[model samples]
Target: MPETSLVTARERAVALLGGEPDDATLRRYLHGIPGVDAVGLEQRAAGLGTRSIKTSSKAWALDRIISLIDLTTLEGADTPGKVRSLVAKAVNPDPADATTPRVAAVCVYGDMVPYAVEALGDAHGDPDAGGVSVAAVATAFPSGRASLEIKLADTAEAVAAGADEIDMVIDRGAFLAGRYGLVFDQIAAVKQACLRPDGTSASLKVILETGELVTYDNVRRASWLSILAGGDFIKTSTGKVQPAATLPVTLLMLEVVRDWHLLTGQRIGVKPAGGIRASKDAVKYLVTVAETVGEEWLQPHLFRFGASSLLNDVLLQRQKLRTGHYSGADYVTID
Candidate 1:
């Protein structure tokens, strides 16, 4: 907390919380940082989502950006009715707005993948008929406080159940306790368990629970660690806590992703989960990806929103443009 030792305090805080600070801790530190007032975080968010670069390779990057938008929702105990309702809303979307880019995947918890897969079959009638990939939250969700054997089994089950991607949370307690190598190995083992039926692997999104990790520095460090350990995507939160995904934390992640891409030449993804509720907020995130990571990450593969109530607003905005008037709120269901 000392001015001359902010850096040291940050290191100590990261150490105190175990090697990986969760979102709650990270947000506290972010708010406590001198000169990073509420407005500063918002300003940082505004700036991080708006950069675009023109290059001879711009067209190629644009295609990559288009592929990175994952529209996600992982409710605690979804039923077939709920899955049907969600799938209907996702696939039909706004008939008046059929041309908008579809999300990369529909993320749900493990129990719902079968329902999702069935719904996709009923509606779209083909493996890829549904407009999104089936992403599952596995390996001891919200709280990564499970044993390794159970965690690996969870990962294997989800992939076997047809999850195209796996979002696994790191064991915060261990990471915060300076067991960096252990956390890294945990991620590696889980990633290995997410292999596809063809022996290829499902893409792995390691949720740092940035809020828990507690600092931009740790978030950055975790970003590098996850990538080094083979994370296909570095997500911001589990949507389990108060500060589950905020603009400032996301900017830090994007900056890390951008730099990592440069250093490793291996493209990684970014997903900001929790508390995003409006189309404007979604666009703000898109803007942040474009500006900070460049246009390369604008797509769902590189970018996504882990939200339950966001799609309605996106549909609302799209419908407003089509009908020249706002539809009654009662008509919206993705909420």
Candidate 2:
């Protein structure tokens, strides 16, 4: 939707709710959601993934994938040096190919946000400014087990350190146990925590840990819950789960986003994290996003890929597309 006719996000959300956010209303609305048809959903996803892109579109898709990457590093062994290296690659993905597009952001741990911000230097603004953003995983990421106060503190510190985005994990345990209100409250709180002293808030990407959600119905519910709680993006996983991201799950989430846009005229973002390691697979996701949402959603704001090794594969494929043959392993740096 265009920016001019759009109402405030808060106004749209309130209109959707019909009243203030509370446990009873949340439960009634979520439970009232239509159940997913697993068989039909899987078939639709399969069909979309099988649609092949022509050679002309493949080149564009490769570059789009590069721009949508979050360039993530969330391991325990992460260091300031590693983050700087990651930021360097994010800024100039292919040193030999200056034309290669830079990635969207460098995602790091909360404590490492400062180093990422520092390393990004002048090239650390919006993608439109020819700069890559610094995204941080906060609120006890990948495992939302911390208290509400701790989660807010985690979010605040990252925002203070200058993270452009916050990828927070929702408490799946609460969601699973039918404590929908608890999960709702926590996500809303974390969204508030992302607010900066300067009045602008960091974008909030609510991680559903979809693998743990187990059912497509839960994925749908959680997607709606996160959006209702003011998440700028609804993410799939934490990269620590068995099934990090899959076409079917991502397609389902996109469907929710599509529906929300239909009702509110506001478009939310979606990030499919983990297990997307190949350029070809990434192309399939691009196709999914375009077909499901629209061609415009291929941009950095509406969609993102939480990836570590995906960039290398994309860079290699990019070289092949330009040079007409696959490049050697040494061409792209290995993470």
Candidate 3:
């Protein structure tokens, strides 16, 4: 389809959900989604994982991986000083090498958005000017066990505090209990709460928490549910749960986003957070994206790795590529 037609289709999809959808309407929409083939899905992801990327291509992939990182720090003990340090590292990932590109954004809890924004300075205003964006994890994050009113308020506070992006978690209980309408409504409500006072809202990334979903079929369903609810991006995990961001899970998400774009002409991003700590692992994800979704999704806006230590490993690999030798842990700053 033509690009213009694709855009129109996506716009129409969003417009169609302008009003509150009834339970029956949501059920019919969800039930209409095709089932996933677990064996086939696993095979495809495993096959892609074995593909080789070498030399110059590897270097290019490493750099691209750095740019796609959402240098994250979501801990109960998080402080302004720690956030500032993280922001500094994000702005200049490779302090020794000025040629290295900055990370896409710094992801923190809602309360830390102001500190991150302040520390980031002009980069927050103009990401193209070597600046980074601030993403806040809200909506009873990691676990959507709160009331809808509280969740919406959490999202609104983040956006109001200068968060350029909001990463929200869906109520897995509602989803598992076949409460598709409730899940859809919660996501739509959060999306609405993302809207800023100036009419420019933070981009919404709905985290499906695939590990808890138990099956590939559920992951596929959750992906479609988020898309239909107007999520700008569909994420795999919150990084708090075990078995986060696995190759097969991320691969499935990539496929979903690819299919969603083809069907709607509106491109949605994918983020594989948690457990992706190595440079090699990050490259494998890049390979999967290039092969599954094409190079267009290679940019930071369309792809992001939700990680903290992953940045250090990427920097080390970059140094090795430039110097033909390995660098020590001391070389990179600790997040």
TM-score of each: 0.76, 0.93, 0.90
Return the top candidate by lDDT: 2
How many clashes in each structure?
30, 0, 1
Give the whole-model CA lDDT for all candidates, comma-separated: 0.66, 0.86, 0.82
Q: Which stretches of candidate 3 lie over 4 Å from their true place?
A: 1-20, 126-129, 326-335
Residue-by-residue lDDT tens digits, candidate 2, 1-335: 11211134445555777765577777788889999999999999888877777645666778889999999999999999999899899999999999999999999999999999999899999974567988999988878888889999999999999998999999999899888778877877777787776667788899999999999999999999998878889999999997999999999999999999897777999999999999868877888999999998988889999999999988888888788785323232121
C-alpha-based local distance difference test score of model 3: 0.82
TM-score of 2: 0.93
**Residue 316, model 3, lDDT:** 77
Decoy 1 TM-score against native: 0.76
Superior by TM-score: candidate 1 or candidate 2: 2
Question: How well does candidate 3 match the true structure in TM-score terms?
Answer: 0.90
